[model samples]
Target: MNWDRLQEKLSILSDAAKYDVSCSSSGSKRTNKGGLGNASFSGICHTYTPDGRCVSLLKILLTNHCIYDCLYCVSRKSNAEVKRTAFSVGEVVSLTMNFYRRNYIEGLFLSSGVMKSPDYTMERLTKIAKKLREEERFHGYIHLKTIPGASPELIHEAGLYADRLSVNIELPTQKGLELLAPDKNHKEMVKPMDEIKQGIVQYKDDKKNKLVKSMKFAPAGQSSQMIIGATQESDLDIVKTATALYKKFDLKRVYYSGYVPVLSDEKLPALNTSVPLVRENRLYQTDWLMRFYEFEPYEIVNADFPNLDLEIDPKLAWALRNREHFPVDVNTADYHMILRIPGIGVRGAKKIIVARRYGRLTYEKLRKLGIAMNRAKYFIHCGKYYVSNDYDSLQLRNLILHSGKSKYTKQFDGQLSLF
Candidate 1:
């Protein structure tokens, strides 16, 4: 193995892997028992160095060589401009071990473009993961990106070694998949996710029944990703699909990657098209409201309003649209009602519930409990502070939007806060 050629391959493959957004290492409880490393439940690759260098996961692809040509993808097999390379299983193992030892990365986030057959590529990926676990005794988090049409047997074997697994849904709708990625099938993608979910369930049942000493099958659970803004699919379409995936497959996370125009195909957006980062951010906020805040997909977006308001977060947008639910009495409101308030988070809502038991909360006291008073003040009434002016919905929305703008201005001006 030539070290120089390996480094060249690493640079190309790592850059190619950045398009994948489903690599978060959260909810994995793989502990190091006389092993090289441990998988923390909190997450990995989320830390910053003293010089502000991010020492996160070593995210890379096993190969950039592909047989199928997806129009939206930069590493599509037909793209002659892209530098192609593939990493042997041994090279990946050596790199992962070395990176862990040097403390450059806390874990591995491995993906690949299709090389030869799906099963052929998957078998190699599984071997790298197996070597990391059994041969190397490396306990650091391993997140493998499973191929869509890979056999169920290889997927099950992958779960035995990987802490987490992901299968990229690629696009929001089946129509989008058919248009952009003719080589991919929506049903094929969901098949692996379903198998992985069942494997996780089976492992738990085995452990409970004492059928196995330690039933390990992706303890962290599975996740998937969707490329946003590629097709004309609405935010409603995206979130609705995500909601179904969570309900049907019991997925941990649904990552949304803003479509960055890389390949200039007539079927795709122009190469100069700006990345819709803010739209992606709004989708994530909408996702959080659904997962943590108990928000339905329809509540965030509907047939009339199929997209989220780009100006504000989804929680605030929902509150604005449904003003009749507003002005909730913070002191007397239930936990769910308090959570529905614009500025109050899960932690803040719990705090309000506990604090109200002792005494009624004022705006000042609410601020101390981590509420974003600027936004919440419009929707919540507590203590002696009653909203004097009954502003219309448009007026109230402008007030909140301006408040957000001002807060960001102050932050840029170096107005720092302790909490």
Candidate 2:
């Protein structure tokens, strides 16, 4: 391949892969040792040092030539306006190796548009990872997109090499997928995911057997991406689907990419439609609450509240909705109940639990634990410093909203004030 031509393909394919938000490099401790690169378990993206040099993951598509014309996608088969290109398995392996050698990127995130078929596309993707490990001895993070409808054998092979694997859920609802992405099926897409899940399980159980203990398979596990705001599905619907994916597949992450209108089509949102980034952030917060904070999906949003309150985060909103659960005794409340307080987090709650064992907690101790006392004060009583008993739910909500325009609320206001 010509050097200039390769760079051109790199530009196009890398730009094309931006829509995927599941490119975060974490959960895999792929050490370099004598190899060319290292993948830190703690993820980092296009981050910069004080000197302003770039440290980014080389996120790119193996090809942008698609067979299906999904209306929301920029590189759909019917869309001729966008440039199309495909990198050979050797080219991608070479590119990733060269890039890693130069310290340009920490890892490679490889996805592609279905080339000839699911199996054909998946073969090339798996080939790159396999060659990188066997030929180049590359130990850097490799995240390979498991093409939907690919065979189980191919997916299993992919798991053997890639650090993490992802199968995009695309749209939130089946109806939306049917209307826009007619070529795809939800069940067919999930088949590969199920296979990957089983592979991960089998690999773990196999590890117990000394013969296969040295082998690793998709060590970072699997994740999926869902496009938000393109279809009419509410936040509640999105979280529900994510909860199902998490429970069924044992996924590591469910990434939400706010839809960006790339082309004008009768079946798609208008080009001028604003991307719902705030809504995307809120959905991620709700996901965190479910995965880490012990909040159920329904607790975040349900039939009565289909959409998250754009003005407040899901945690604060939940506290506002269930005011009766408030006025908790900070000194006596269990760790779980402490987590329910508006301003307390898992770490803060744990700290409170440990600190209270030594002595009764006062406002000073709570602050020392990094609890947001401004918000917690309204719902917590500690050392005779209880909030006034007069405020109703409505009043308390307002008080929480306007009482302190701290950096957090100011940033929140900046994000949502446009509405």
Candidate 3:
């Protein structure tokens, strides 16, 4: 291997892969079979896992050369300014093994631009993964980005080795694709997603029926990403698209990437415009509500409110809008109803339910159960302690905002919350 050339390729391709945010390695329990490494169910990305383990992965692209001219993409074919580089299959496998041995990364996240064709690009990706698993005997996590128009045979081979697969939709709506990337459409993207979903289901069914003792097809399940603020699509549109994808494809995750202006185009946001980080964070919070809090898409966002409130979270926003559901008696409310309160999380609600079996929960006891009394006080009541229900929606919103700010100022000396 040419050391200088390999270093150059790594510098460019690794930087290019930063734009893709769907690189998470959770839900895979690929154990070490007398192999090199193991993939825990806790996950191993550049983020903290559920058990507070900070794991990292070697996220990089195979190549930056492409055949499509996506206006929003920095690695598009029409952009002649970007320095292009491609990594041979051997080089990628070597880099992953060397990195894992050196304690630099726990796994590999490989994506690429459409090199000669979709099949050509996907073939190289699958080959790299195959080499790592079969030849190198690597059991660590492997996440491969599936090309939209790639052949199903190649994708199937990829699933045999990879722990997780992802296909980025790029944009929320078909109209956005038409405007920014005329060559791509939602149909082609959905095809690969459906294929991966079916593959996972088939493996599960076969294992359940005792037809096969050992079979692994993308054991971590599949996920996708959509670009926010790239085109004219409301939050409602994004939420509905995500909800449909989860329902139809059984996706494990749907990531939201705020658009960063890399190229100037008539159809794209300006270079000086700020990235919609707040909107993207709000959308992720809304996704959490839908997944964990049992919130329906229409309940969080509808035609009446097309965009999320940048100031507050989706759960609190919903509680404020429908005041009739407030003043919930925590002592008697069920799990789902208590979950609707602004300050009560899923764990807190479960704890409340378990703790109430002994005696009536007072305000202090409820606080001890880890409920945020600053916001929950206005919407819930315990035994003998009831917050006055005289404040209207507007007044309640202002009060909550004020109290939250004051508490932050007092606790942390006026430092704002990052989220």
Candidate 4:
């Protein structure tokens, strides 16, 4: 193999793949049955696992050459500044084996630009994964970014080998796609998503009915990504789209990538404009609320408030908006109501439920249980001990902000006070 040429491709393709944040290896239980590697259910890429161990994946694109001229994409065909490159199937297989042997990565995350066509591109991706699994006996995790217009047969074949498959929605709304990415549409994207979803369901049903003994079709399940701040879609629009996709597709995750404004275009954001990192973070927090905290999309963002409050989290914003729900009685409130209290998470709510059974939970006991008392005190009350005064929402907001800052100031002063 040409080492110098392969290194150049690695530099270009790996850098190109950095924009994709949907490449997680979690939820896969592909064991190493006399293979090169194992994909544990706890493993995730560039993120902490449930057991607090951080794992890595060899994330790279199959190629950067494309046919479409997307205004938001750096790898668009019109972009002459980006150095284009491609990797053969064998080279990708070789690279995965080499990286795994050296302990550089626990798994592989492979995505690609549309080289010639979607099927043409997806075929190469599937081949690389097939070679890794069948020929090389590599049981490591593999995440393939499914092309939108790829044939369903190819997509089904890809799922049989890949641990997780993701189809990037790219933009949040159809209007954004029409403006920046004219060639793409939501229909084409949703097709592959539906196919992957059905495949996952069918596999589970077949396994349960004892119709199939050894069949794995994307065992980690499929996820998708949407780019934020590229167009005029409001946070409400994005959240609604995400909620629909999650319900319709049964997705494992819906990743949000804040627009970086890498390329200059008439339709895209200005290159100098700040990336919407806070908005993206807030959206992820809202997503967690919907998925884990049982928050409905309307409850988080609706016609009254279309966007998230960047200053505070979604749960706190919700509590502050509906002041009638505040000052929940920790000792008497149900699990779901206790979950809605600001600064109290799922674990804390569970602990309160268990602790209150033995005895009433006081403010001090709640603080001892690792609840953020500074924020929770205003929203919760124990028996005969009201922690919050009759302050309005606006006043409560200011007080909370001030108290947080004051705590930080006191900590800083104690470390550096000259007196």
Choose 1 or 3, whichever is better by lDDT.
3
**Worst ten in a row by lDDT for model 2:** 410-419
For candidate 4, the lDDT comes to: 0.86
Q: In candidate 4, how many Å is residue 402 off?
A: 2.0
Which is the better candidate, 2 or 4, if ranked by TM-score? 4
* Residue 377 error, candidate 1, Å: 0.8
Candidate-wise lDDT, in order: 0.85, 0.83, 0.87, 0.86
* lDDT tens per residue, model 4, 1-419: 99999999999998888888887678888767797888888865553322233448888899999999888788999998999999999999999899889888888999999999999999999999999999999998899999999999999999999999999998999998998889999999999999999999999988898756757999999999998887878899999999999999999999888887676666443533645578988998999999999899999999999999999889999998898876788999999999999999999999999999999987678979999877877777675445434557787788687774321111122452110
> lDDT per residue, candidate 2, 76-157, as tens digits?
9999899898899999988888877887777888999999899999999999999999889888889999999888889999
Clashes of 1: 1
Candidate 2, overall lDDT? 0.83
Give the per-residue lDDT digits (tens) of candidate 3, residues 71-132.
88899998888999999999999999999998888999999999999999999999999999
Kindly provide the TM-score of model 2 when superposed on the true structure, using C-alpha atoms. 0.92
In the predicted model 3, the residue pairs found to clash are none
- Candidate with top lDDT is 3
- What's the CA error at residue 93 for candidate 4, in Å? 0.9
